[model samples]
Target: MNHAMATPTGNAAAKITRLPFLPLASSAVAKPRNSSRANFYKEVLESARDKFTRAISFQSKDKDISLAKALHYVAAEDEAYLAYNREIDAFALQNERSDTSSPHDAQGFEAVENMPMDGKNMNEWLVEIDAIAKEVEAELVSRDIGCHLAEVLEAVNKVLFETRGFKRSHVVVDSKCLYLHSVLSSGSASAILLSVIYIEVCRRLNLTIVGSRVGDEFLIWPPTGNPEELFKVTSGRSLFGIVNGKCVDDPRSKASDINSSSLLGLEIATNRDIIGIALANLIRFYWKRASKTNYGLMLTSPLRSAHRSEEKFSKDNCSEMPLLRPQELRLAIMASERLLILQPHSWALRRDYGMMLYYNREYEAAVQELSICMAFAPEEESEVLEPFVEKLHLMRLEKSWKSSLGQKGRLTVT
Candidate 1:
């Protein structure tokens, strides 16, 4: 824990100290006479702490407390985004007040806003990764290891996998394997996360690491003119072993099995795509768990006409399943919301979000979101979503009527 304190200014002369592992704590203090700002800051701090607590206290099947720590990473990424925007706004304000501006200031702001918000939390993990990279660089310098791709790859592999014991986790669905922080702490991660770590470390070493998606898997390597030759040199493997669609097994018998055609067939994944993949995994895991519960299916079921008696909505038939905790469903919704932030125009994602909102019994929000989805969705998708939006509107009205009736009954009794 770094014991750094910020020098207070003007009316707000109270010193602010850093909290261990949480920079948001420093924002607890606010300018004097600004109650709204103070309240807002307080809310931010409390929300972050609550999220962190929930993440740490999450119960897992194997009694492992650390398994659900990815929740914290997700929350941290959101906080990082908010912090980034705050900084940009502050900088712009400062420039405006100073009456000094650069030719590209507005363009820079627009570019920043347009950039994908993937891996905003990478900076939090980079400090440790940068240290590890520095160690590898120092070792290479000492051993006279030049910047040859193979030599650098070998050194990085030894340091990360051998010395540090970082390896690919067999259980890809586990939350522990999906997040960078948990991966670093547990010494095991899924293929994508391991690739992310590798990419980050190589970035620190001034080596470029590019990723490509082959089927469902993300594989990364150094950029080279002769990719096949480089694959042969690197033995057609990465830190996670053979880079195949099914990352777990090595079915290739020889180096020649990795041909130029297969390598060229790989579709390059942008940073946004990688982060989307990770969130998509989380959505799958949470949704799968939610679906096992009795009421879970109803949340996503399409609203059918009253003429279709068999598929009609009925509250009597739906019962809460204790096994499917609300937190799990909420986590799935949170992941979906974050993914939507990255790809705001994705009507399919918006539809999913609206469905999840419906499941959560937020009928008004569900109707609003699904209506937006209808506007951008194709004709077929829009048709399918129409009933859902209408049903949600009806549900909202019914809820309001019930509340009003309850109030009227109370007045009559009084």
Candidate 2:
């Protein structure tokens, strides 16, 4: 299949290879500078000036400056900015095509806007939401829930469909389908399943459920409650509740293991983080498949081929803009930057950033970013990316060699 459409722009001479590598520095990353908001400005620009100088040196054709020396520096800071923009552009394009639903409509089902409400009464909101759920259950007719946990999903899906036209595929995408598949296929922990699904639906429905991170688990709290009332649902816990006609949890169920103030508040989860989480789960799940038959190749080959083919199909039939909604895409792009700043040493973030660059047609920049990523996180080099990079560099070398030979030939012929 034609990978041209999916591949970010550039000639064959700029790609970086995917290979086992060593850490450029280390794997440790500093935590967010602030708890509520990410102060990524300082950290993102946090680069060594020598790296920029080294990059400038590469522009020189002097024989004394070796290729390796030309490349060794703090890393290209300007390249990082260019790559960040490339990612934003790619994300915007994909989301435009995946416009299956609009997330902006704030009206609840049945024009619940004018519905009579007992003002300021928490009990009334809970009752109303349950009543809505019950009414939805009784009135709506739905096909069988085809998968596991299908019943709960069917009940909710019906509510969303009747209330807010939420399509199944959108629901699945918003849910951690990628992560769940990795977990189930790989047999890892099952903790994040329920929260992931709930959060996905909530986002689509504009229900304002905030995501939470607790210990090794994930959680969500409905926006209808005070932030203090948030619970531990993300941990795949046994209890759930409803507030203001929304499913939620009472604050009493908050995990004792967590600090009260540090709980993830009303802020929405960024698409980048969600995607990152999905990818991490995929890597972790496939970590143990070191054998030949059910090995890393087995896991990655199909995935890579499928991605390539899907990219080709999308290109042939349609264009890939961004895979996320516009506002969501903005948040993702910002979050990715924040992540890179906070976790400068994270291989996964670097690799993702590089991949983002590659898809955006910033080939040379992608190579540089990915090289660093490979250095930090060598274990998960993509076979496809590696060959692409090698081919790119070789092509450039060949072109230069051919140009010199042609010049010599012209002189000799003269």
Candidate 3:
């Protein structure tokens, strides 16, 4: 454990302190769900709750325990987090028709509570996702002779995105439904979210289609160029592995040994990376909301102008942003907290948390987090936080000055 990992994690309501964490499981595979998907989610939820209850009770029973005991407590907390997160995802499907707020509804704290991952919702989601995956599988299965990779690609692009009318959201990328249910319903998503859809389909089919990150752009494997080259790989570790079937990465093989065709530009996005990106997208949405000093002014932005004109406003929020202009930093703060939970050693995420604290006017906490971020950063990336910490100190001083002035002004008024 690093020095920073020892810090106790206090919630937003608690004073700023170090948050202790369990080592992230390299891969926490979801247990295979029964055909009864509803029961599967219910079982997961119950299991998580039982583990949480046991952890607390077990601690009480073994009060004078060792470090390992304390570790057990942390493990249980994480297990609960895993289950709760799934339950939370289901809430996204809640009456999209009734709660027809603008896709760009400046997500706040309430939105955090909306993502539920219960049995009922999980069943619906699996069915929807499978509906798309099954067709592609059937197509591939029918072709006993190897199907051309272009044909496979065309089938995927056609069924998932084109036929279903999935498109990248215009102007303001609304991340409201980038997850399973909402994405299927709205068919509007970002690149990473779409990649998830693609990846999931590939997983079902045992294909090796992966999400690739080349600089700023996110691309999926097997690019559209040169249709002649995209033959479906049979056995023996071919470059273009089956997308929806088993992942056959030659773990022992060197990069030099692998086929060049497998390389899709630079970095292949990991499962952790994909999940982290989704959380970051939500955080980005909230961060934008926090940055706005005035919702009235923001409503006038050209990005949202056409949307404004297209719809009539309800008496309450003008049907614009139901969750607009979060005055408190709750959503952003929560987002940063989740990011930290997911990617603890991530200096970049720590910096994001530091900035969130800065924006929330928790100057001391902000400085501490930035300091930790600086410490955690890799040697090559060490300078990333030098300028950040300096700016934070200056801001702290300025905040002190402002506080003094405010106190003096209040005294004078009195």
Candidate 4:
């Protein structure tokens, strides 16, 4: 129980306070001369510049929260990229203006550089979480809690579960449980999110809590302790064990037999892996919803044989799911893409992404992705993927041909 309390690391707000302002105007250096195309480029750059400037001010400072924010931005890549471009444009603009601007203008620009970015809507959850951790820390200090591993953990549990009322969501498909902000507000989250909260709060208290994926459940324990001893801690027994349906009656005897093997089987999750798992869960949830539609039917159905009815793609039999929400497919794709960013070389992930694109009617991109999968996927997987790749190529060709015919018909009408 005589555990040492580690030194507290600076939070996101503290880090933000130390970061210098981004030099926005410096990017306006290469102002394009007036022309239709140049005008378009100029407008785009200006818009992107403005958004990027705004986005930078709101970017999350905490690592895990930032990754969650990144997942949110995956579906909005166009906006994120525009914001990125804005940062570049601002610097160019500022550099161009610096030489000709008067002393007063220069002074004003310098003053702008010192101002902190607005911290309102974008990832405000980071601030709220920081506040939660601080509150826990203050509580522990005010009560004169010792640095014993069990004591600090009990204190954390009291603040989070009893006072704050955070609980586990029983519904497996609940999307709200997957998001950090939703979990914070709703007080119910999936195991991974709860573990994240537990880890983060403990981190602020100078304690280390590490997580492992045990079977389908994510379990956490202090970095240094007897696994069974820590498991006896009330929070561990109730919150982690019972919630996961792995609780045992007797502490020492049954706990050891059950957890001993689980302890050995535990695959320690890195921060990146945890984020990837969250996105994977989202992909699964969205895909489940999407699969009920004709457009997403391929996910549940077997691949069509090469000789199977050509009438499948005929005008009267076009694959369309009027009942399916397009947003669900897009979300599944975005979640898959975000997971890929964390694990780029995973051919299984690439294959899933390719399939999502195929269902979304992006045949060309699907073909490209599946082709990559075919190249690297295991021979067995490649055999399964080859048919999708071939079908996508045919679909791409048909789409192009139809487009050409439509254009010709339009010309004839004109």
lDDT tens readout by residue for model 4, 360-406: 77776676666666555677666665554555576677789989998
Q: Regarding TM-score, does 2 or 4 come out ahead?
A: 4
Compose the digit string of candidate 2's lDDT tens values, residues 306-342: 3363443221111232232232222233334434543
Instruction: Rank all candidate structures by their lDDT, best first, as comma-separated numbers.
Output: 1, 4, 3, 2
Candidate 4, after superposition: displacement of residue 168 in Å?
Answer: 0.9
Residues 91-158 of candidate 1: C-alpha lDDT, one tens digit per residue: 55655688755323222212111222234333445466878898788768977967876778778877
The candidate scoring highest on lDDT is: 1
Candidate closest to the true structure, highest TM-score = 4
Residue 373 local lDDT, model 2: 54
Residue 257 accuracy (lDDT) in model 2: 39
| Per-model TM against the reference | 0.65, 0.29, 0.49, 0.65
Q: After superposition, how far is residue 303 of candidate 4 from its true place, in Å?
A: 2.3
Higher-scoring candidate on TM-score, 1 or 4: 4
Which lDDT values do the candidates have, in the order given? 0.57, 0.37, 0.49, 0.56
State the local distance difference test value for candidate 2: 0.37
Worst 10 residues of 1 by lDDT: 1-10
The TM-score of candidate 4 is 0.65
How many residue pairs of model 3 clash at the backbone? 30
lDDT computed for candidate 3: 0.49
